[model samples]
Target: MSVWRRYLVKDVTGRLVDLPSRLFDSADDGTAPLPHFAGRCVELVAAVIVGDRVSHGRVTELAFTKLYFDQLGYVDAAKRERMIRLMLESCADRRCGSHRQDSHRQGDCSRLAHRAGAARDQLSREFGWEPKPDERDAALSRLDPARLRAAHREPAQTLH
Candidate 1:
């Protein structure tokens, strides 16, 4: 069975771009790149929490993660929901610089916040579920990925 999936990407005009499934398929040996599943989750969250100053860096990191997710077959509903909540939480920052350009505080990625909302909505629509409040803060605060090791995934290589 083919496990095809799609996602929302941001266009130059700040519109949601519907990435097609054909983009996920591999032609040479029929194997796409690995989805850095957890890595993606981390980057998306960082983009919001870190604000606009670091948004580009974080998005760059998540881009690879998204590719890996597509290659590994999309995540389950629960995990997807968790990711959405994080996006929502990050976007809730009141000091979004793009929307408040005059603000003195640094790192205000208001544009990314909007994109996060779009992504959260798209994920919610695709999964047919309502977005719930984030209850992962306490747990997330104590989380440390540096402790994780080899069991997470194998190294990448050419499929063909």
Candidate 2:
């Protein structure tokens, strides 16, 4: 695995507090890099929360956690709802490719299952409503990664 991957998987300290400095240090002209490192910080934070071994930084803060989840496509109220619905469906006894792999490899299932449940709870708390059955079905039907990606690209207005 590459250094970034290793760092992500093994480094318990999620302290990238100096990420700004690290990213800016390489810029001789003082201009921030494209795709801004600050923007990527959110992704890293999400990755850490999703099981990457990053532990130094605090991820529980409302602003930072919200930013990270937003960048990961969980901030849009609709998307978040859809994600939770999909998770609930996946949690059902039905079998599928992803579920099969997860069953064969418990580690993946544990991480994914934990993350899904957590995301669902987080959405429920934010939205203040229990998930409806139709919403659950819609979420399950859209669980395929390709379909989800396409939905994300659609210009549909987000609830958030």
Candidate 3:
């Protein structure tokens, strides 16, 4: 097991990009402490903001949860709910794209888009916002084959 102290730093939440980078670093260590876990929370917030424009919210969220679990190991229902709610709020403005490049070959591209669209709608409803159907579809369509493959190849736990 690798020592995790090198990833530790204090009073850095206000720095946006540095936050996620720190979180990403800590996540690789399996023994990050509670305060470092708190830092990961900061990273999650900043990541939601930075990734909003680039469609990486889900990716960041997965990492956030992993570090959260690493720090606390087990959180009760109330705390877990609060964290999830915070995540949803931070990412409320972002859209997730699930464009499928293999759809044409498999004739299942529409299904992929539909599933992604439905997930988006569920997120919007949970956050008390109307889902933008057309905009989401357009965004998915804009995802080129290369991007889709990259997204698909990402860790399954890294987000949708």
Candidate 4:
């Protein structure tokens, strides 16, 4: 039998949601698992904010617990820090979209920004990860919606 334990996060309606067990799988060389877990956490937070799926506060709480307290064996300090950075970037992206020129999407994006910011702050506080001065500015610039849109206008590059 596998030694890994299943993890759950509570939704907005107070229902328990299962997180994939693969997220907790350790690397074969005894290294901590990679940043997929962090990406998954960002996806969950985005679902709650953009898709209106769950309780943002509760989900973030459990996310922090999973990343910091619960899965320390599978995720090391570096991984946890990377996860926190991912959450921060998501927040910055949502916030930037709020300032877009499209008025129709502005209101929705503003609401999403607020929700994402709350989740981001909660995770930062809980995980004790803070972006450096340069990183704070870099995160915003990197996720700027206008820049993202311009980049997507180019032809898609195919991977070999």
Candidate 5:
């Protein structure tokens, strides 16, 4: 197991990202105390931000949660702004349930996408990563082909 993978724990919350226990203080190494990401959790925050796909709600949740969990950006108004912008850029889907849940009266889908894209310029500097051209396509391309392959290709594996 790679050192990084050891600290990686699947979120029971059912979102598709691997969260770091060190950041959340959920690391359970029996040998000794693990370093916590109380104030320097930039990488973990980036990973979560990157993992945000398919659901605008998840991005919104991550954005709000990072205010406390990620020590690097919450204190800066600009950083917080960029995070909001990213969430907005992720809001192109008119059918997204997250838009309906916004208590702020931001139910307009195109407006949401516009708001999210507002922070594109600051993404790299703030989060140490930037979206690629056609970023959604890139996100889709990251899927593991093996996991998506048909499982019952062989006759014995078929129910019939």
Candidate 6:
């Protein structure tokens, strides 16, 4: 019996690009680049979370964790833990600068927070990778209410 799977990736332009199953088959046989395929998977998840919008770095980290969880079979426990640490560190780093603030709106933060929470829950439940209290707090803090309010208030300045 043959099992078939279909994959879709979101391009930088936000278009949903369907990846051919043959690409996976080729990668399995060493005829295609695994890194490229993995990069596409990351891009796919990132696109789902942020669409065409420019996202905060933490948003991308959450998306990466989501992708990793979705394809747990491909990742070992050690690597998964490392990725989790990297995600938390990236999220906890507060020097995100003005680009992050300029890019995200309130709705974007809500979506990112929702997805990050889901990823955290799945990590704890399935992988036995419980995040530290500070890490958890840092992840949640990425969805700053002040930043959301600032983004919300920006439109008012243009309302003249």
- Top of the candidates by lDDT: 4
Model 5 stretches astray by more than 4 angstroms: 1-35, 45-82, 89-118, 128-160
Judging by TM-score against the true structure, name the best candidate: 4
What RMSD, rounded to one decimal, does every model reach?
17.2, 17.7, 15.3, 17.4, 13.7, 18.5
lDDT of 4 at 146: 37
Question: Which residue pairs of candidate 5 clash?
Answer: 85-116, 88-116, 89-116
Please give the RMSD of candidate 2 to the true structure. Answer: 17.7
TM-score per candidate = 0.21, 0.21, 0.25, 0.28, 0.26, 0.26
Ten contiguous residues with the weakest lDDT in model 6: 44-53
Per-residue lDDT over 1-160 for candidate 3, one digit per residue giving the tens place of the 0 to 100 score: 1211111122353221233345444443534434534333222221221233344322222112122333452212344465466555445333333444454534454454555556555544433322143322222223222334565577422222
Q: Rate the local accuracy (lDDT) of all candidates.
A: 0.34, 0.34, 0.35, 0.41, 0.34, 0.40
Question: Number of backbone collisions per candidate, in order?
Answer: 4, 2, 0, 1, 3, 0
Give the alpha carbon lDDT tens digit for every residue of 23-111 in model 4: 43452133555443333322121111121223211111112243432243344556567666757655664445424377757766777
Residue range 22-113, candidate 2, lDDT tens digits: 34233313343423322232322111112223432211211112222233222233444664675574464322234346345666556666
* Residue 43 C-alpha lDDT in model 3: 22
Give the Cα error of residue 11 in candidate 1, in Å: 28
Name the regions of candidate 1 deviating beyond 4 angstroms.
1-62, 66-74, 95-160
Q: What number of backbone clashes does candidate 1 have, counting pairs of residues 3 or more apart or in separate chains?
A: 4
Model 4: colliding residue pairs: 12-55
Q: What is the lDDT of residue 146 in candidate 6?
A: 38
lDDT of 1: 0.34
Question: Comparing 1 and 3 by lDDT, which wins?
Answer: 3
Whose TM-score is higher: candidate 1's or candidate 6's? 6
What lDDT does candidate 1 reach at residue 87?
56
For residue 158, give model 1's deviation from the true position in Å: 25
TM-score of 5: 0.26
